[model samples]
Target: MKAPAISLLAGLLFGAGLAVSGMADPARVRAFLDLFGAWDPMLAFVMAGALMPMTIAWLVQQRMPRPIACEAFDLPGTGLLDAKLLLGAILFGIGWGIGGLCPGPALADLAIAPSEAGIFVVAMLAGMTAHRITRG
Candidate 1:
């Protein structure tokens, strides 16, 4: 019960932050990716702002035995640089560069402007489904 509530609250807060920060805007994100022409630095600043708290959380997490809402941290166990990881990174980079709306912002944008985000969301789901089927 507590975990679910905390998860929901955390998700809502993250979505709200993305929306307020204009990270939910695809055009804005695309502009940020653009380097040679009309590049935007706002996203860089937003990412830097986000990294601050995350850095502190990581430091705190290292000292803690258990998470506040969970028995233990469910973090990734490996730091291995293998084919699967490299392939996934490439795929993610391609998607992010092309769509300019990654999962987080896309999900929030669905609520903010469904019409604009609908295609990307649908495509994203289809990709996920395809991955599941192929992975099996």
Candidate 2:
């Protein structure tokens, strides 16, 4: 119960932050990705802001005996950059470049532009399902 409630609150906060930061707008994200063309620097600031807190969180995580709402931290297993990782990253980058909305931004856009974002979310779920079937 505690974990589920905390998860919901965290998700809501994340969506609200994305909405407030203009990341919910696919056009804004596209503008940021357009480096040689009409590049926007606002998203860089937002990324830096996120990284600062995440850096602090990582430091804090090291000292904590256990996670607040879980028995242990579910951290990544390995740091190895392998073929599967590279392929997934390429696919994700291509999707983001063509669609201008990755998972987080797409989820954030759902409340504001349901029809468009819903299509994206459904497609994303389909891709995830395919991956699970193929990989597992």
Candidate 2 on 98-129: residue-level lDDT in tens? 78899998998888999999998999999999
How would you encode candidate 1's per-residue C-alpha lDDT over 41-120 as one tens digit per residue? Answer: 99899999999899999999999989998888899786879887898889988888888899999999999899878999
lDDT of 1 at 13: 99
Measured with C-alpha atoms, the lDDT of residue 8 in candidate 1 is: 98
Q: How close is every model to the real structure, measured as TM-score?
A: 0.92, 0.94
Clashing pairs in 1: none
Off by over 4 Å in 1: none
Best by TM-score: 2
CA lDDT of 101 in candidate 2? 90
